[model samples]
Target: MRRIRVAAAQMGPIQKAETREQVVARMIALMDDAAGKGADFIVYPELALTTFFPRWYHADRAEADHWFEAQMPGPQTQPLFDRAREHGMAMSFGYAELTPDGHHFNTSILVDKSGAIIGKYRKIHLPGHDEYDEERAFQHLEKRYFEPGDLGFPVWRMLGGIFGMCICNDRRWPETYRVMGLQGVEMVVLGFNTPSVNSQKGEEGIEQRMFHHRLSLQAGAYQNATWVVAVAKAGSEDGHHLMGGTMIVDPDGFIVAQLGHEDDGVLVHDCDLDATRFGKETIFDFARHRRIAHYGLITGRVGAEPPPEE
Candidate 1:
């Protein structure tokens, strides 16, 4: 039985005034709780070490860089790693990354039980605009602060299954899951910080926002026949409300575990990795069912164009 106990470590608001050390300490406390619950793996939300800074626009580069880490497991994050190693717990978490070359990316890293970095995935589908719009309630300047991720969707063999990682907006893209699905992924872990209100969809309500989040995750899990562990950085941050519906979905797309509160909490569940086999080999079998030849537009076309000649 390839069973692994996992936890969706949902975080509450990280106040704008909070420091990285304070946030890491809070994460460690959540890790302690997950460990006590016998969880083998814990998934944390995107930008785990800071508030959702992208909600506000920063004119100065130095101000924006403050939210980014110069190195993985850097000084502020090393304690979390140390604690994970001590407890023999594997973890996946997200953060803003600043490369040595000064480029920045929204990144997530997977750490094995031994506290070794096993895989890393940078967020590819960046949402929002670069320029700030005064008419909007708040700014989502991710495009201005982060460069498009250079790393493609990749899967790694870890914790007795094929694991893949994606961050925030990447969860909304079908291509993100399909790439990993094609790689035979058995599980996909993701972190998100979605606001309850979006400027692009100003008329939409919070119910719709949460519904879309779950819909995307459920669809991705069922289509790929993979377990999905999605964590959220939710609640109001400096008066800005964010949605929190952290959940764990089975290979059949049913939510087996979910957090009910918009606060710091953990939802633990024992997931059987082998549960994916039945679906993979039957109705959803990619090898036997997928018609790649008919998907030429997905692979070849860049923008809207005419259909292929008959």
Candidate 2:
């Protein structure tokens, strides 16, 4: 049946004072928990190693750089790899990546059951502005700290299926899934760190934000005919409240498993990859139903003149 038992490893907030060791220990505990539940794979949230730091503006580059990791399996993160190896579990997680060239990006990586790195994806659609504005409740300076991802949407063949990865803000965009969908992706793993309140839309309610989050994930899963594992790092972190709505969506747009806690928890589901065949071969068979010629405007030109009236 090509079934995979997946776990949405939703994490509680990481306090600003917490060390990397403490965070990694929390992740390992979750890994062990998932393994005990017979989960073959686990998905962790964005910036899983530390607090969401973009909320505060940093004038010094070094101070900001401290939040990023220079290497994936560096000393601080090696234990995660070891835990995955010990459990023979495949996993995906997000982190702040600092390149040797002095560039930084919001990155996520996939690891095989053997704990070998499968592939990586840098977040393309970075949210928030680079400059801080005094009018907002809190700063969301993602653009200020990380460069736009250079790596395009890529998919990999692993665990008896095609897999793809995306980060927090990337999940809100349809193009993020469509690109991987074109590659015949069977599963998509995404992690997010979303605030309960929108600083830009101050009047927006939390219910609306949660709706949008689930709507995007369901839409992406159903439209692409792929299973989606979306995890969250939520709750109050350093007094800032974030949303917690971790879930696993089936190819039919149904949320099979979900988390209802604002604390560290794991939600496991046995997902049948074969279930995607029906949608892909019938309703969402892109190769048979897609018309690309008319889509030139999507990439060719922006704000082009409209067609003349009849």
What is the TM-score of each predicted model, taking all chains together?
0.97, 0.97
- Cα displacement (angstroms), candidate 1, residue 161, comes to 0.8
Q: Which 10-residue window in model 1 sums to the lowest lDDT?
A: 55-64
| Model 1 global lDDT (CA atoms, 0 to 1) | 0.92
Q: Counting only residues 3 or more apart in sequence or on different chains, how many pairs clash (N, Cα, C under 3 Å) in candidate 2?
A: 0
Residue 102, model 1: lDDT of: 88
lDDT of 2 at 84: 96
Highest lDDT among the candidates is held by which one? 2
Model 1 ranges off by over 4 Å: 306-310
Error of 2 at 297 (Å): 1.8
- For every model shown, the clashing-pair count is 0, 0
Clashing pairs in 2: none
**Among all windows of ten consecutive residues in candidate 2, which has the lowest summed lDDT?**
297-306
